[model samples]
Target: MEEKAKSFEELKPMLRPTGVEPGIMKVDPEKCTSCGLCIQNCPFKCLEMDEDEHPKMKSGCVCISCSNCIVACPVDALSIERVYTVKGGFFDTETPAVKMPMPPKDADGTPAEWNEVERVVLERRSVRHYKKKPVPEPLLTRVLEAGRFAPSGGNHQPWKFTVVTDPEFIAELEATLHGFWSGVYPVFNNDETVMNMVGVVETGVFDPRTQYGIRCIALKELPVYLGAPVIVYMGAHTKLNNPALTIGICGQNMNIVANSLGLGACWTNFGAVPLNAMPELKQRLGFGEEWTVVTALVLGYPKFKQFGMVARHYRPVTWFRPGTKTPQTEK
Candidate 1:
């Protein structure tokens, strides 16, 4: 067998940090309302209310600077102060060269025209039907690169992509999930008592469409992965701040890049739900206990061409202005 060339990690020198410091949580007492939203939203649960009902970090707790507390503060009372710095490592101080040129602009420095990126974003769709043609390795690599460049909280970049192209393995995984769902479909379908016992109805989460989709998946009518030739499993470190959110951003980048490459891509939670439940299967797939299957994307050539901007449902938006006492609502 031919030996592979040096990998990217192999070619780069390892960087060892000399020291590390976590971010400090800061609270504005005047702006704080003792709502406890910041404390409730902190992933680490390292925050507590002081005697005056002000939020403060608990002793022996370190902030990873995920910024969840800041975002959850409706009155903007909380913030994280501190920068991540490293020294005494084989780190490059010089700025790297820009690989891509800037977007074209008009004389006034505004966008010149409706660009390709905008067009691609507008025309992108969740493709369900796919052709049998396999996605090329180079195109798949580009999609992974797009995901790799996605921004993460505190620049942690805590994500791993597993590309599966093996037809037999994909089929086996699909069949296993289908079997599990098939066994539970009867309880999920006919037995309202069981569904109620599971708190599905009490939570006001019962939806006919969701049940129908589940039925299709259980019956193997929906083909959990849509029979795509390539599946990208995205896993992330759960300890990091907002791992799901980071994975979502990374998946979006991959989907957009897949669309640009004339490939159909669909984000699927079907596989993730089942795979996460199966610890042995997850371990076999090389995911450690610390990492979780955040989501997956199926990629393939579309059976039919889909283009042009699609109409989307409008959502209510509220805008707050400096001069306005009440915020303006757009419906």
Candidate 2:
């Protein structure tokens, strides 16, 4: 009986959705590139590429609103928004004029110049390997506190944050992340290899592999994650309006806060992929049935290397319609 009970416990579900609403992450199919970036970054595995070659939310309890999809989108097209509502509201609502606060005007009654935010966005690098040093607790607390104050829809304030500093837990999470990479490697970028009579077949179709794969290699090769010594896991309210947007705002806020504190941080959805695949991992991290993983940012000191922004390569900007001054037919 004891052994049977233990087996059942091992097989038990780690979480269950409240069903008050069918939780989902809405992906704009028209803007989708089938890049799989969102799918790879989603901590809850709530997103997967569909037959239409668009992202689809596959799990009811998988959305954690880490906002990785929004940042990873090559085109400023993808956004993370709520899938369901506990209380039905207007589906098509305009921005309420009443909610607007009139800024102090110029002497001519024109609005004043835009005020800059306290925080500035940094040129963030996707840091894979760390130096295996621990981040200071006070600094980590300050980062979380910055997230705690992020804006929400109608002040829903439904976000939850859990920080894991335990080395064993971090190691376990890393193992799960590696497991995810091992499984998804073949699917991403067409890396499937078939074995024949030889020891093993080799397929190098996907060049450079994934950033995470490269990071795994760096962890072995160089002191990357640069011994920052800490990993911060962010969890957000999955049911809020534009949950992805809110989480993005909050996550960026945390990043800026960290930057201001003289600490370096890198945001990635690598940790989330495995957490989504295995529920027990979520439970172990202290998330109940109702919550989801939004994103994970590895924090640490840098290897004294400065990675600045690169020149942005982009398609030409096109306008919807040509000026009326010129006819449709061009010279």
Clashes (N, CA, C under 3 Å) per candidate: 0, 16
Q: lDDT values of the candidates?
A: 0.71, 0.54
**Candidate 1 steric clashes:** 0
lDDT of 2 by residue, 191-289 (tens): 222112012212221212232343442343222222336777666656666666777788888887776676767776656534645778777776666
| Candidate 1: stretches off by over 4 Å | 1-113, 190-205
lDDT of 1 by residue, 1-331 (tens): 9876544344223211224343578899999999887676553455899999999987755454555566556787876555222233333232222122235688899877657898788767677667889899999999999999999989989899888899999998888878877876677544333433242223212323344456667766567787889889999988888988999999999999999999988888777656777999888787889989988999999766444342232444689989888989864
TM-score of 1: 0.62
Candidate 1 lowest-lDDT run of ten: 92-101
Q: Residue 272 error for model 2, in Å?
A: 1.5
In candidate 2, where is summed lDDT lowest over 10 consecutive residues? Answer: 91-100
RMSD in angstroms between candidate 1 and the native structure over all alpha carbons: 20.8
